[model samples]
Target: MVNVGIGLAVGALLLFGGWVVTAGLATRSVSAVNAVFLSYVASLGIIGIYVLLARRPITGTQTDLVFALLSGVFLAIGTVSFYGALTRGDMAIVSAIAALYFIVPVVVDVVYFETNLGATNLLGLGLAVVAVVLITV
Candidate 1:
């Protein structure tokens, strides 16, 4: 299993690369929808290559597949919206707003997964919200 700190660092690095590519595409008069499609296609190719290198049998139950599909749908919608915002707004502000999406999963975990949200967690969430508000304003 990957260490959580390493996983998070890798994820952040990959996301930063994505944002740079998207920003470059945005400057080239690419429509947000088209940019999103292109990015997904590129991601698919990279993931395919990784799967090949890993050489593990891909296996999932029907429920897992359905959940994956649903998540993909939501991801597409969110990406399109984010790309659209990037085109029309300041990239820094747009990115700050987009970063706040973490709140959704936190809320979902607390409400549906019954995950405990301790005082520190709630304080961190509140601070994040305030930081974004301050950035946007």
Candidate 2:
């Protein structure tokens, strides 16, 4: 059995750590696009190996496929934009701006998923925006 909360925590931790490393290493490269591309290539290799080892079927329902493809597209766009921003600005500032990306999912959940958008959630969202500003400055 898997723990969803643990998975989320680990995933978020990895994202933060990976971004920090990417910010530092990408600076050594001349082209941010190239850096992003190379990272994806490496991911391909890792994922390929994992698929081979796990021996899981590389198939899914139409819904799964659509969402998986969309995830890849969104992540690719986000990573490229983040790397480009990292090259041109402070890592903290770029990461803070990137954190604002959460707002999209939250809004989508409220509007489409019929999620409860309580006052506490609204206040948290406002604080998130304020935090980005405070941290960047």
Candidate 3:
């Protein structure tokens, strides 16, 4: 359990670091579309190297590959959209608004996966939504 918690914390830190680098690159780039495309290509290269070095065999079904591809597509769209939003809107406002996406996955997990949304979780989710609303308004 301790290792799992540490792993999660490290993962979160890495994610934020990635986001910071991507956002800075997007801001500096002349074109958001190109930035997003190049970012994805860079990510693919890193992941490919990791897979090769780790010797993780790819055994996923076609459906799994399709879903993974779709996820990449969605990520590309999101990256472009976020960069565009940041260019047109205040950075703080755009980031706060984008944070609302947290609600979508939480709701989906609760509804589709029948995950247990305990009282504390529900309260936290509600507070997050409220914060987004307040920040935007």
Candidate 4:
């Protein structure tokens, strides 16, 4: 059977990739902060609607809430910075560097979560680095 989780993740990847390109293009006409603020507002409104339609309960433990708050803060900071970079720098270079952020999670998973990467995974990671380098230069 096809893995629904993997399929959804691929869908998310495509969606986010498109979002990056769209944001890069759209932010060209506005200040980075203004663009990011509007982006988040639109996202919040859309997600809020989805939650309401799905009757999704927004409930969590105290720790979960705290983590969620931190996540939001970090996301806002990163998004604003990314938009700023996109507006000020060549989009290809900015995006190549931005894509390297994936390394952080991989490191965290390997170190703290004791997760292991297969040979293929490691090869893919190396290839991604090479791809970014090629893109930037």
Candidate 5:
């Protein structure tokens, strides 16, 4: 319970901080591309420093390394595009649309991974689609 709570708290803090920074920069006339770069680099530096200070070994197996690299590349593309949209559109609407990107992985799980998505999961997916439509239109 303590571990789950810590995870939830940390994840929320990270997400909230990311959104505030992105929106604040976008509203302050910073170009979306630059904002993405700034945020990415700053995050890398801050986290890297922390890991170093903690005397932790920065280690990953080969498969983990590949996945980590791919994750960073994929995230950079998405974050850059999202920040770009934020610069030109209402944050509320843009974020709602961008948030729907999570559906991709959900779909991949069902299609590619053959994961069993129960009725509740299917309904959740339907609701997510409805949400995107509501926000977009």
Candidate 6:
């Protein structure tokens, strides 16, 4: 439970940080792709420094590295899409729509991943989706 709360807090911080960075990029640049690419480069530099200081060895398998790279690519694309949306749409609406990604992991787990969900958990997810809809609408 504590971990869950911490994860939520971290997720909120990421969203807020992303929004601020995206807004700043929009003010200075016209290309969302450029902004996302530069952001990823900066993130990579920061992460590399952290990993070096932590003395963490890169021991992951090729498949794992591939997946991680794919995740980074998708993140860059998503960031560009998000910034473009923010530029064209209301920030509140865009942010709420972006928050739908939270519900996606649950859906993916339950459906494609064949994971089980309790009745209570299903209800909670439903409520969350409803809340997102309400907030965005």
Q: Considering every candidate listed, which one attains the maximal TM-score?
A: 4
lDDT assessment of candidate 1:
0.86
Q: Spell out the clash pairs found in candidate 4.
A: none
* Model 3, runs deviating above 4 Å: 21-25
* Best-matching candidate per lDDT: 4
Candidate 4: Cα lDDT at 118: 97
The digit string of per-residue lDDT tens for model 2 on 1-137 reads 76999999899889877766766577666577888888888889999999999999869999999999999999999888888887888877777788798899898998999999889989999999999989988
Model 6, 4-82: lDDT tens digits are 9899999989977665656655735466666666766887899899998999777799999999989978877788888
Measured on C-alpha atoms, candidate 2 has an lDDT of 0.84
Candidate 5 C-alpha lDDT tens digits along 1-137: 56998999899979976775566566568887788878878889999999989998758898998999999899899887877777778777777777777789888888999999899988998998898888888
Q: Listing every candidate in turn, what is its Cα RMSD in Å to the true structure after a full C-alpha superposition? A: 2.7, 2.5, 2.6, 1.8, 2.6, 3.1
Clashing pairs in 6: none
Deviation (Å) of 47 in candidate 2: 1.3
TM-score attained by model 6: 0.77
Worst 10 residues of 1 by lDDT: 19-28
lDDT of each: 0.86, 0.84, 0.79, 0.92, 0.81, 0.77
Worst 10 residues of 4 by lDDT: 19-28
In order of appearance, the predictions have TM-scores of 0.84, 0.85, 0.78, 0.88, 0.82, 0.77
Quote the lDDT for 81 in model 2.
Answer: 80
- Where in model 2 is the C-alpha error above 4 Å? 1-4
Who is ahead in lDDT, 3 or 5? 5
Which RMSD does model 1 reach against the true structure? Answer: 2.7
Q: Which model, 4 or 6, shows the larger TM-score?
A: 4
User: Which prediction has more favorable TM-score, 3 or 4?
Assistant: 4
Better of 1 and 5 by TM-score: 1
Q: Which should have the higher TM-score, number 1 or number 3?
A: 1
How far out, in Å, is residue 2 in model 4? 4.6
Rank candidates, lDDT, best first.
4, 1, 2, 5, 3, 6
Model 6 has an lDDT value of: 0.77
